[model samples]
Target: MDKVNRFIQFNDESVETRKLLLYERIAQALSNTPYMKVTERQLIEYQPKEATLAISVFWRHRTEEVTNLGRLSDIYLLSAGFYRQFDLTAWRTFTTDIKPHSYPKLARQLLMLLEEFRMMESIQKSRAGTQRAFKVRRDIYAEFHRDRLLSNAQRGFLADALINQLYLDIHIGMTSSPHDVFDRLPIDRVRQVAQRIFETETTSQSASLAFQIIALVEEFLTGDIVLPLYTFGEAFEDGKPMKQSSKAMESEEQGESDVKETIEEEFRTWHRETEEEKGMHLEFDLQHGTEGASDASDSKPGNEDAEVQSFGTGRSEGNEKEIGAQPEIEQQQDQSVEPTLQAGSDYGHAHTQVTFKVMEVANKTDTSSLSTLSAWRINHLPIVRALVTEMKKRLERKRQYKRENLTKGRLSSKLTTMLTDERPKPFYRKQAPSPELDAVFGLLVDGSASMIDKLAETKEAVVLFHDVLRELNVTHEIASYYEDTFEASKEQQPNFFEVMHSFDENRVDSGPAIMNFEAHEDNRDGFAIRWMANQLGNRPEHHKFLLVFSDGEPSAFGYDRNGIIDTAEAVWETEKRGISVVHLFLSSQQPTEDQRELFATMFGNKTASSDSVEEFASQTLRILRKLLAIAVQ
Candidate 1:
């Protein structure tokens, strides 16, 4: 394949991979059946009449397009319901006994619908959340079939009654319009049919039951059972005609060949009679030096000289002004329109380009230094453990108001009141620990040339950071950013933003990706931060933290002084959207007055600076504690 085709294929595979991974995580959390598994397949691969138990989702309906958490939750609930209740072996045996040739397609379809309704009801009884998801899905399905049902109703088709029965079954007790045709159906009869199907001992019996129900509905429709037929009068009121078109009077319909082009054109002379006369007069004056020419001879010589000099100077100034204005106009147009940046490619973004290269530390001794740092962190694990414990406590407190669970820590005030207010006995309950954390972290490292000297220390600090977060089971991503030196230009930004690690349950293996980080080219801090923020912003996490590791101000082509302002603005925008952005300065030397002011302007009080490589780990830990405190609070 060519480059374009290869790029498209890679993106398609990446999306599918991400979706499969997400599905696996959800299944692991919710599926109790040991053999249950879920995978993605193209919708076209599955036959319309196939009876296999699998979910068919289009590529466009991936989790990223919808609410990822909710979509995954719904998928899990559906999968779990199928796994728990759907006996594949029994279903296969039943299908074999009945045979596809013996079963009517309509009867099979009705059986499938009944099975889906039963599964949803069963799952909803155990999970209140699943109830909401099922309701949404049912409503969507009903809307999709609304037109077909209406058309069938107009034709007095018995299948319309069956579909309406399914709709009424799904929306059993929900409030609906009084005039709705489905509401007019015998709801109790529909319920009885559904209950009978649910009580079937086997899939074969269920199919037989479904066919009987269909026959009964057909007989009822053909017999005295009166379905309230929809009428045009119900939708529109009688009214007088407002206007009539000319075509309405035509007795014969117009054919395509009868149509003709309606456009007409006329041409007129350009010069008018008065304009031609004036042109002749001007020519006569130029040829014979007429009376009009003598009028200039009557002017004073001094006044004429002044006018001549003023005219010459104005022409010179006009030429110079035009010359100076051309570049400014082009610059204004350039600034007014920003080119779109295509992501997930090496040389994509108009202002930034990205490439993946193995990270190399200049000093071989730095590897030993990293080992030494790791040893120190191991010794200090007790302190880190204490910090983690405290942070979890705060998180638990924050989550208490939103959740109710049995706990031994305290008595339930409401329960106590109910039991002791009238009686002599009191009741007590304990709160359960929160099931999940509501935070996600994004670590953005500056990969500019200036970071080369501090690369080793940064790597060690990042590895330790990863370890700490892993222990806490926090969802996070680590990325590095720098300009692509060869492709960098003022007009086209070729900055590279590399993902060292992604947010995944299996984050323990991120050490290798992080270790591959190496400094490169220049840095565009604001653009890189915005890109990272976009990644974190779409996440369902309540508390988002984007930590930036850089030495000084952003430096890139056309980004020297304005880069600082842009970075500050990007930070403010991120924080305004409920994300916390913290800057970490990695210079070993003491920060100068200028550095302090610049850092303060970019990060306010959320900025932390390390004096040397030895203190990198300690400083990072301190900064993380501060960040966690703010997030938990």
Candidate 2:
């Protein structure tokens, strides 16, 4: 086999573009609107009915330079945690304006949003602490490739940032609404600027890397490319049984036809070339008038000296035309033989290397066998599944290894047997933790008039988080919002209401909250979120986090009776206590003055607002983690 023989054809331009698109789509799917499950983080694409939240809302990561599914997912989650970065207020204004038959609303909205985004971009630049942390975080992300898992602490770091910092003043300076975030900036124009900056930055790394990439792509498209060859899936197509008759028959005929012509042509060409080479060798010997000699003639037969024969063997000649003619003919023979030997050696070496490589691929049968490969080559559970699918694919690969070799090398029989053995090993079967229970801490929902819709999704989160937490045997307490003058002072950390935080110890907490709409405010910060954070803060060393299930406005918290300034003071006090808050915007439609105020006060820029309860959970959890990340370390 020659270097030319070890070639594989692939289309580059279309193929690379297709691959790049595939990668981009994967990013889209993972970062799509709505929420994906904790398990579905890497497996981002989903049918609408499969989830309660929009994929975009739930996904909390952004586009990355690399395309590793896992890394992209993390980055996606990171972005999803801060989904407000790419504000769609401009688009939102476009729609709202269309409804009103007014372009001014749209124009103002776009202008405001563009200003906000520009501010955000500037904020990103000015914030040295955030940039330093992000740089450190990028380094930690590289560790994830090696470790395959971000420690709880590392995840907490990201969550903490999202919860505490609004991604470095990207939303600072002027007050802005969702419609004002990205409205002003022309998307095409902005993209052009970004593209130019990137082009300038990337040009310095390698001037020809882009061109090399293009060249490699063109070679594939034109069918003028070659790749190293190795054996794979040989036992699959020929050895595996087909599940369906139609597929079996169709593939059977196709496989037979294709393999027959291909193998025949290939083998015939190889054999013809080989014979031609052998004949040439014999011809050169005869041309030198070297008659057939006994096997014992080259050196002492069956002796060490026989192996010592040099490259330029003296040609047999007698009574030549002249002395010069004899030496010249010998020189010609040397020239011819050396080049032939060189060509033969090159082919021979390649064949040997390829054979070994072919044998190196594993023959996996099922998930269990795939587990072993994952244990060796990977660390993520998601990657293990991909390997299993690829291993099970029934394709016929040429057996370039485990065959005859023209040269002899050391025989490491033990190693050969070890590698060739096909054994199954189960993966993703991580044993649950002992007792499998985390500590207990339940949420207090605001069952006020405005919070009714918000509670549905909040209740669902309670159930899900409870189920997972309970399985881990973590004890918890449940509480809900209800204001009363009967409770004590803000510094004293008064209870929301009488008996609002009680639940069956043996069961998961799902107790009803005591709503106090008639009481001071609507029970927002005055009692609900304020009281709950204080409660969680009291119990330390448990992964205790609070999900402030509210539209977050303090209007419901009776500012008239208790004074709005006091409510604001309570919010700051809660923050000082290290209680993380995840705001779940129940319904942005007809938002109360209170809801709008609360949404801005608590969530800042990355607020989670959804029309549907179910759809809200996926995004809520992502936001929860990001919010919690700030408090973790």
Candidate 3:
């Protein structure tokens, strides 16, 4: 029976994964932002700065399509419509005015609740497809709040009951309170104001209405809000509106009290299911003499008195300049434009606390390094030449086309008779003899410790990639990445991308610098891909390609559970920006079926497996040929 239950649980998880993938694609399309992602949380919230759209998991029990679609539509409306139109300055002013009121939290919840109606009305009028989903939402909420209204009124929580009554009236045309317990309250005036929810067009206008209603009803309230179930998300603090907090804000209402005691009390009084209602709590602390204390000591190779660097939500000057503006696709128009990178935008939520440092290869000009480069170049010169020849032939074939009758081009000797006869079309043009490939490439070589034995062959393949691109006059960047696992801790993990060649140094003779590459501690594939994609997205080339060379394993500090999913998401986001990604699996013998399947899931079908050095070189050339062909075409 236990095995059978486990099988059922696995199937349920599989279905959820597939559903989340589909929803993510929908979010990317609807938001018109390539980096926009959908995730599951306790409530429907939109974090614009993080580019995350979270749907409430409470409604997951409703397996009907209408309920699911309505939930997704709610996130879409929050992300695309309300986030842009809401006025943060006005909201802050309102919150300050009501901060000392008897029902400050209830007043804030009322404002959010009213804003939803206004936003839904505004967004649904613009998008026709959202109509049915919203109808489902209205029907479901109408039923749920009817029961909540009766319960709150019976407990003498007038303000909370009033909120429920207002919601029912606005959405479902309910009149008066459910029980006649609010005879002294100004129900008629409140309903008159709530009726204007459909009339208000902006969040500021909704705030005005909410303020008026709270003024008339605050004196009748007694305690804190019975259940702040109508919140959109966390209120804006510190001026960065719609940004996500790294710490969980869902536990704030419960304070720092005993979790079990608080939950038990709420259950006994309200008969409420508050367990899943409260989202996950996260805490970070610095501990001394823990399990892995030696790993954090300076006895490691590079951790001797090193300075601790910090990564924050704010963008650095360099990051801003690197992620400058580009063309954005119009959401309403049917056109094909490459996705743009907003300044300081992150592709996925992983590695939010991680910092990346771009470094040059160490000891590049040292005597031993120079000697190694010279000998290495001598050993691999033959294969590099051969690969260059094969790639150039393919590129030339793609560039083979001619125009015999052109008005303005190089004069052809064969068409001289037409010119003599005073014909208008006498000139002919052939393709440029040495045309530039309208493409840029980024090669991210894995620097994990697992690559130690394969470093020699890997360098050969990399040198071939670099030398050929140089021969063809194409712009490309080659770098290796790794994390210092020995020195890593919970609060901070530093990743490095050591550059052997950059696009700006295309004219320089740095081919020998490729010999300085070495295997390092660990590899975080998703973070590395995202960093490289950010660099490549700034280029003006028409075609962009990112090639990753690894053994299809992503291992790093605190990256075990979501490593594969995050890597796949990074690949999807990069491709959405019109950059093609291909993976090459390096191994000695043939890869097992599991390995191949893993690579396929992460990289899609654009993957190649190499069994030896010769096969690696050949596969690298083949991938380049395909990319160049796409570029020329």
Candidate 4:
């Protein structure tokens, strides 16, 4: 049994993990079952038939028949699980009454396919998610069939039409057209007949209807007779029903019982042996070499004395090696500790602040020109909407806390007030101001010359982000920071930070300001982050987030080598003061090892990067979602 268990290998770890997660998502969709008990089921990748995608079976009988049906199989298994939760005794009886074996191979296959469609339709009526899963599976199958197996022939047309009709019937967004080959097939009529037959309220009527459909399809495919496949609701009359022998049934039961008992005995034996070994060790420890004296008569003569001497020699050698390696290990550990960033007196002289009035900045911005950039026109509205929805849900959850008030909630407070006469009138509980209502965001874009190529896409992302935040009514500030190339000197402040949008302005139309953003000079990331953090930290909002957009390493007049460390330290300090900082790396090229390490050091797990401009918005939203999840929790 153990050998057999070992031989039944599952799929790759990652593949199995994904399959399990998919199963969980589908199961959660069907959690509202009201009739038959729904037990949590495991999904194994197995092929019961050559064309079978997936099927459900008892856990104890799981097989290793592998299938390569991809995502379609996942949805099929999910749909099967959904249907299995309902009472299908009538459907099962109707199927069994047909005696599928009595029909031809094509008729049997058609029956099975029609049964699957019927079950799916029934499940879809109650479970909308099931309908979606069916549509996805149908689409996948359609693609595979059309691209690979479909041929321009009569049989191929029939097969394609059958699948196309199924897809059209289940998909809410799909419509029939004259261009479609399946348009000529009376799919609606076929569905109507199937539904009418299945819902006859009697097993005999339902079985008769199913047989009629099967015969009609058979006649359509093969020009032939119009006889029923089998007697409608009667058992097989021509052949004798086979029964299992009593002896065989008893032997099978005994075999299963024997296997169970054998497993139980093995566990007991292992446990008992473990206990005995522990007892022996305890006895030996208490004796402490006095075992020779206590059991002198039972001791083996010279061999026992030789074993003790050998054991002592081996222990001595092992102790010497351990003692010799200790210092080197300790030294290595000391060397591995990361050094902390230290601020020098000259650090404050590297960057100077630059502020601009909203009207002045807006006037200089060419919104129309910026909008014409190719990258700016990339459609990312879907991603923006999804992100906004996620953020709103988090905020809503935060605001839904129970609070104590004197208006309306529980009767207990009112009853207490009545009993104590604490107030002139009875007091009722009501919700108070939620602590999590306040949240502030800071958007910092690196205005270094290196970002010139990425500026268009970066601006687009910032604009979308600004729009989403404004829609959500979140307080946020957008700023661009760069060093002044003309003023850059060892003895003077060279860095300039430009404020495009401030929290106090509550501006929704910041598109002009975002468009005005242009690349200039070098970047002093640490100083800019520290300055941004200072502004965000002063806000009254409990949840403060500062997101930085940068291309690569920071390069300023005197802060190039130490800028990464400085930024990392600044991030740590900001987080220590209850401010969440995330870094978004926008680069058209793949990130180098050093680049990844620098960003990881500064942002930890709060960093996200996009190798292409198109993914910038999505990557930013992904990071935002993670940050919001932690902040809300």
RMSD of each: 28.3, 37.1, 15.9, 23.2
Candidate 1 RMSD to the real structure = 28.3
The digit string of per-residue lDDT tens for model 2 on 1-633 reads 001111342421011122222334443454463222221222222222121111221222433333333333333422232222322323333334334432222223223223323432433465432344334333444343223212322443322221111212122211222112223323223232322222222212212222222222222221111211111111121322222345335866777432222212222333333334332221234266566766764564356555655544334575444333446644643543222111121212111111000001111135653444334223323433442233223111111123322134434334454355564122122222222222335455554445554543454554444433333344555444543334423322122332233334435232222211112224434344555555567675445555555544444212332223333334444555664444556553544444444445434433466655655545544553343333222
lDDT of 3 by residue, 18-135 (tens): 3566778876676555556677767776554445667776666676796577666666566656556666666667787887778777778888888778777777878777788788
Model 1 error, position 418 (Å): 11
Q: What digit string (tens of lDDT, one per residue) describes model 4 on residues 1-633?
A: 001112334631111322333443443344321111112224322111111113222222223322223343344443343224322344344445555434433333334344444555666676565565566555654554344323422444454344334433433223443124434445455555654534543334544554665554543442221322212111212212123334435866787332211212222333333233221111122344443344466865556545343322222335656444345545444543333222222133223222111121341355466555334435666766777777667666656654453454564533565666655344344344343436789998988887888877888788777777776677889988777767756644344555667787675566776788888877777787887887887899878999999887667766654455556656766888989888888887667655565567667778877878788877876776676566666
Span of 10 residues, lowest total lDDT, candidate 2: 352-361
Residue pairs in collision within model 3:
none
Give the Å error, residue 571, model 4: 1.6
Put down candidate 1 lDDT per residue, 26-45, tens digits, no spaces.
65466532222344443211
Which run of 10 residues does model 4 get worst, by summed lDDT? Answer: 44-53
Best by lDDT: 3
Task: Give the lDDT of residue 609 in candidate 3.
Answer: 93
* Deviating ranges (above 4 Å) for candidate 1: 1-380, 393-432
lDDT of 2 at 139: 48
lDDT (CA) for every model shown?
0.56, 0.34, 0.70, 0.53
